[model samples]
Target: MLAYLADVFSALSELNHSLQGRELNIVTASEKLAAFKEKLVLWIKRVKRGNLVNFPCLEETVTENSTLPPTFVAKIVEHMQMLCTSFDGYFSCGELQTCNIWILNPFMQNLEDVDDDGSIKEDLIDMRHNCGIQMEFTNSQLDHFLASQREAYPALATKGLEVLVPFATTYLCEQGFSCLLHIKTKSRNRLNSEHDMRVALSTKTLRFDAIMEKKQQ
Candidate 1:
């Protein structure tokens, strides 16, 4: 479903040639999103009827027991609304013109302005207004700016860049879950200890020769 939506977003071009390389603007996105969601809702119902897909982790294979019910489908449909609400502010922050202004909302409400320590500094705040607008208004652009100007901005570069990068999916999370499954299969139900499990699951290899040379030294 995610891959399908991604393709649709990539293919759907604005009539104006000026937006040829850019992502879909809000108004265009709304129309496309509504159409996509309508089709998606119907497709989801069909999948439920077809009984092809499986729950991510569970061992259950029975269609009658595993397939999502109608109420659950309706709940899933509300996710589009939730997504739109979430993106409304973040999208505003995507533009250089509005990005800093939206970020510095005094209530600490804008996601980019939010600091966990509640000790956001004046220098960092000044950097936002001073530098954020001059840069290109894209996640990749900001990432490149930090990569190039680490000495110039220091910690503020990291702080500002962190919030701009969006989380599209749990790709790493799903990979880690699959790794856990591979490590703890039916054959090996449990490890002796958490430390043992960590050692077993780690991708690193032993450097016995290096350790021996250090010991000799």
Candidate 2:
């Protein structure tokens, strides 16, 4: 049972890392989450048949003479089912399902299957044919692609933006909290937190050498 839990935690850690990225958008997150839930369903079925392939340590410890207790296997299956349910309850949204259709890669999707009016379908067809648009879509992130298309394809861009703009995880929020903890220490409690936070959270690097040269002049 311990080995089983350890394996489960390992998988969860990977999933958590995958979800925690600056560029993670709803489209990508929904895909990862759906894949994870499918894996859980598979694991539940395998576990019932005494398949310990996923849990290597458990498999190693068990011999042909040894049998897995029915109650223990039942508990493990129940736990996995609960995890699947929790994930479905949290990430299951109609908008997420809709975005899963084509925003990730419009070129790979069938135009007829996309749940949009004729304009979006036209935009997709245009995007598929245009060499420059195809190159941009291939090189840029989904959010960037949608943003760049706003002028050329207003309706498509708007729909994509509705899915892309929302944060997929609480990573940024947690990062801000951690930054605040570092910035607003007891010694610096009375200091101006706003400016300090702005500097700390900024992705831009300050050029100290340039600043020094200007100061000397």
Worst 10 residues of 2 by lDDT: 92-101
Candidate 2: pairs in clash: none
Question: What TM-score number comes out for model 2?
Answer: 0.87
lDDT of 1: 0.46
Error (Å) of candidate 1 at residue 53 is 27
* Candidate that scores best on TM-score: 2
**Which runs of model 2 end up more than 4 angstroms from their true locations?**
63-65, 93-100, 115-118
What are the RMSD figures for all models against the true structure?
14.3, 2.5
Q: How would you encode candidate 2's per-residue C-alpha lDDT over 95-208 as one tens digit per residue?
A: 445534787687888766786654888888888889998898889988898999899999989888887899888999999899999988999788778888887888899897
Give all TM-scores, in the order shown. Answer: 0.30, 0.87
